[model samples]
Target: MTASAPQVPPRVRVSEASLNVLRSHTDQLTTAVNLHLEGTLPWYRQLTTDERASLRLIAQRGIMGLVNWLDNPQTRSLPLVNELLGSAPTDLMRSISLQRALQLIRTIVEAVEHRLPGLVPVGDQQGMLEAVLRYSREVAFAIADVYARAAESRGAWDSRLEALLVDAVLRGEASEQITSRASAVGWGSTCGVVVVVGPAPEQADAAFMSHLRRQCVRFAADAVVGVQGDRLVLLLGGVTDLDTGLERIMPSFGPGHVVYSRIEGSIDQAHRCAQAAYSGHAAAPAWTLAPNPVPADDLLPERALAGDDTARQMLRDAIFAPLAEAGNGLLETVTAYISAGHSLEGTARELYVHPNTVRYRLRRVTDITGWDPTEPRDAYVLQTALAVGRL
Candidate 1:
C-alpha cells in the first residue's frame, strides 16, 4: 500500500502581547541602530539560539534593523528601509500582520528549497516555521526591550566588537588557528576572494570593504563592506572573475555607485593582492592581478627566456665587453651598422664618419669577436645578443 505524504502542521497564531512587544522593541531598536554606516551592525546581544539564527538571516539581508518590513529581507531591505523612514513603520507593521502567515510559509519554503530546490512541497514546514517565526518575533521583542533600557551600554560594546571584526580582516594577521576555528564554524565554499579598494574622496585614510555574499535563494552575489585599517577592504567570496565580482556589486547599490575597481586574487592570496591593488591605485599604476595558479606544463616567463644562455652570453659578451670597457663607441658603431642594414656606406653615413672608417671598425670587431658581419645570421645574432644583454 502506498503511504500518504506527511501533512504540514498549521501555523500557531501569535499572541497580541507578543506582537505588541515585537513592535515596541522594533521601534526602539530602529532608533538605537546608528544608520551612518553599511556593514557594521551592532553585536546582537541576548536572545535565544533560535533568535540569534533568525537575526543572522535577517542580518544577511544587509539591514538587520528592518527584518519585518522587507518580506524578502535579502532583497527588499534597503528599499523598504527607505520607504519606512520616509513616512512611518506603523502602516508597515499593520501590513506585515496581513502577511504573517505568508511570511511563515516563505521561511519554511526557503529552508526546504535550499536543500532540494525542485522537491514537492511538504506541509511539515508550515507548523515548524510558524513556531520559529513566533519565537523570532518574541526574541526581537525582547531585544527591543533591552535596547530601550540599555541603549548606551549595549551600543558601545556592539560598536567595539564590530570594529574589531573589521580590524581583524584587514590586518591579515588572522592566524591559521583563528581561520581554522572560523572554518570549524563552517563557512561555505568560497571559490575565490576579491579585495575591494575603496575610493573615499573625503578623507586621507578612508577605505571601504565589500564582502560579497551569495543569496542562498537565487544564488545571486553582491558585496557587503566593512572598514579595514585606514581603508575599507571588502572580501568578496564565491566569484571567479574580478570583473564579474565588481559587476555583481555595482548594480546592487542601484545606481550612484560610481567608483574605481580592481580585484585582488583568490581568498588564499588576498593579503598580497589587496596590498598590490591598493598600491597600484594610489600610485596611478596598473592594477596588480594575482595570476591564477597553473600546472608545470604551462609555459612561463622563464620558459620564454630559455635558449642557449651560455653560447648567447659568451658571443654577446665577447662582442661588446671590449667596447663597454673602453667606451660606448664600439657599442654605438655596432648599433649604427645594424640600423644601416649592415651596409658599409650606410653605416658610415649614419655615424657621420668615412665609409672606410666603418669598414675598419667592422673588421676589427670580426677579428676580436670572431663574428663576421658578412654572415647575415652572425649580424642577427649580434643584434639579438645586444638586446637580451641589456634586458
Candidate 2:
C-alpha cells in the first residue's frame, strides 16, 4: 500500500477567550495608538481638538474591527475597514493623509502586539498576532482604496464645476454664483486672464483633457477647460507672456485654428475675453493665411463680416474712433490710400499734397490706430473698421 500522506493541522485561529480579551482592551489599544501618533507625528499635534477626536474615533473603530475579524476569521473585513474611515468628515479626512493613516494603523497593531503576552494564552497569542497582521494589512489597503475613490470623485466634481464656470463666462454671466464657482476651482488670480478657443480634439476624453491641464501647469499657468460641442474653450490665468504661453500649449489643440483673446485685467473680466475668442474661432475659417495660434484681435475683420456685433463695435472703437479723433487729415489719407490701391503717390495726388505728406500721415495712422494701411492684413482690418464706422 502507498504510504498515507501525513495529516496537516488546520491553520491556527484566535480562540473565543482571546477574542473576548482583545475586545475588552479595544479602548486601551485605541488610546495607545492615539498617544503614539501624537508623540511621533508632528502633524498630528497640530490638529484641532475636534479633528483629533475624529481620529481617535477612527482608531477605536479600527481596533474594534480587528477584534471582530479575529472572532470570525473567514468574514470579509475590508468593508468593515472601509466603513471605519469613510465616516470621517471631508476636512478631517483631508487632514489625515494616507501616509499618516498607515502610520496610525501600524501603531495600533504594535500596541496590540505589545499587550498580547498578558491578554491571551500562549497558544492563542500567535494566532492573535497573525490575525492582527492580516487585519492591519487589509486596513492599509482599505485606506488607500478609500483615498483613491475620494480623489476620483473630487476630480469628477471639479471637472463639472470647471465646465459650468466656462459656460457662465461664455454666456457673459458675472455674478456671485460665478465667483463662487471660480473659488471652488481655486481660480483666485487677480492677475490678467485670457480665453483660448479651438476645435476639440477627435478624442477629447478625460485622459486627454487631464493631459492638457497638466501641460498648462507645466507652463506655469492655470486653465479651466470646457468642451462645448466641437469647440474647445480654455480660460488661462497667471500667464506672464501670452504669446509664449500660447505657443507652449498650442499642441494641446486639435487640427484647426487656435485663437486667444486679449488679456483681461482679471477673471472678472474674462467674459469679454471669452466673447472675443468665441467670435474669432467662429470666423477663423474665413482667414486662410491666418497663423495657427492667431490672436482673437487679429480676426476682427472676419468676425465683423460674420456679424459679430462685439467685433464690429471693437473695430469701430479701437480702430476707427482713434483715427477719426486724431486730426491732421489722418482718416482721409487712410481712406484715400486704401482707395488708391495703397499707393502713396496716388493718395498724395488725391489729397493734393506731396507724397512725403501722405507718407507722414500713413505713419500717423499706424501710430494712432495700431494698424498700417500698407500691410495687407492691417489694410483689411482698417478697411473693415472704416466700413463699420460708416455704418
Candidate 3:
C-alpha cells in the first residue's frame, strides 16, 4: 500500500464551543467599542447622532466579521471584511477622514481583544486571540484597499471629463454643456482664465502632467490640460497674471514656441482665447525671434500675414484705427517715417517739419499704440500692421 501524506490542519481552528461563545457575545463586543469611542475620542462627540449610529453599525459588522472568520469551515477562507463594511453610507467618507476611520477601527479591534479571554473557552484562548489579531489586520488592509479603489475610480472619471472639456474648447463648441462641465472640473467665474498652446513633448508620461499640476498649485492656479497628437493645450485659471503663471509651467512643453492668450474673467469665454492662442501658435514660426511664451496678440502680424481674418481685424483696430483716431498728423508722420528708411532727419526733412516735431509725434505714436517706432521688433510690427490696415 502507498503511504498517505500527512494532513495539515488550517491555521485557525476554533472549536464549536468557542464559536458559540463569540456568537452569543457579539452585542457585548459592539457595546465595548462604543464605550471606548465615547471615552477616548473627543472628535467622536462632535459627530451628528446619525453619523454616530452609522459608525456603530460598522463596528458591529466588524465584530461579526471576526466571528464568521473563526467559525468558517474552509481553513484558508478570508473574512468578508468588505461586505461587512460595505453597508456604511458613502457620505461617511466625506464626513470622517481616513485617520479618524483608522482610529475607529483600532478602537473596535482593541475592544474585541480586551473581551476575548471571557468570550472564548480557556483551552482555546491563545488561538482565539491570535486569530482576532490577524482578522483585525485583514480589516485594516480591506479598508485601505476600498479607499484606494475609490480614489482611483474618481481620478479616472475626472480625467475623461477633463478630456471632453478640453476637446470642446479646441473645437470651439460653446454650449450650456460646456458651462456645466467647466464647473465639474473646478473652473469658476471668480478666477482669471488664460489659454496656452504648444507642441506636446515626445514620450511624455502621465507623471509629467502630475508634476505640472503640482506646479500650478504652487502658483495658486488650476489647469485643465489635454495632449492631442503633437499639440498640447491648457486652460488655466486662478492666475492674476497669465505671463507669470506660464513662466512656472513653460518648462513642461516641448521644444517649440508656446503661445498664451489674454487673461479673461471666466473660463466660459476661454474658448475664444484658446482659438487665438492656437492661431498665433500656428503662425509663431514666422517670427523667429519670438519669445517662448509669446502673447497671442503679439503674433498678430504673422497671423494676419497668414490670412487670419481676426488678426487682420485686430491690426486694423489696435494699430491703424488708434493712430487714425488720434489725428495729430500721427498717421501721416508714421507713414512718412517708415518711408524715410527710419531716418529721423530724413523723415523731418521730407515732411517739412522740425526734427523735434517729428520726434514728438513718434513719442505720441508709442503712447497710443504701445509700440516704439525706433526699436526693430516694434518697427516691424508697426510696418506690418500699417500694410495690413491699408489693405
What's the TM-score of every candidate structure? 0.30, 0.90, 0.87
| Shift of residue 376 alpha carbon in model 3, Å | 1.1
Kindly report which residue pairs in candidate 3 clash with one another: none
Choose 1 or 2, whichever is better by lDDT: 2
Query: Which of the two, 2 or 3, has more TM-score?
Result: 2
lDDT of 2 by residue, 32-95 (tens): 7787778877888998898888888877777787776665555554576555555753544567
Lowest summed lDDT across 10 adjacent residues in model 3 is found at: 73-82
Give me the runs in candidate 3 sitting further than 4 Å from their true place: 1-10, 71-79, 89-95, 170-176, 188-191, 203-206, 240-244
Give the top-scoring candidate (lDDT).
Answer: 2
Candidate 1 lDDT, tens digit per residue, 73-103? 2323234434433322222232233233234
TM-score of candidate 1 against the unseen true structure: 0.30
Candidate with better lDDT, 1 vs 3: 3
CA lDDT of every candidate: 0.43, 0.81, 0.80
Q: State the number of backbone clashes in model 1.
A: 10
lDDT ranking of the models:
2, 3, 1
> Which candidate has the top score in TM-score?
2
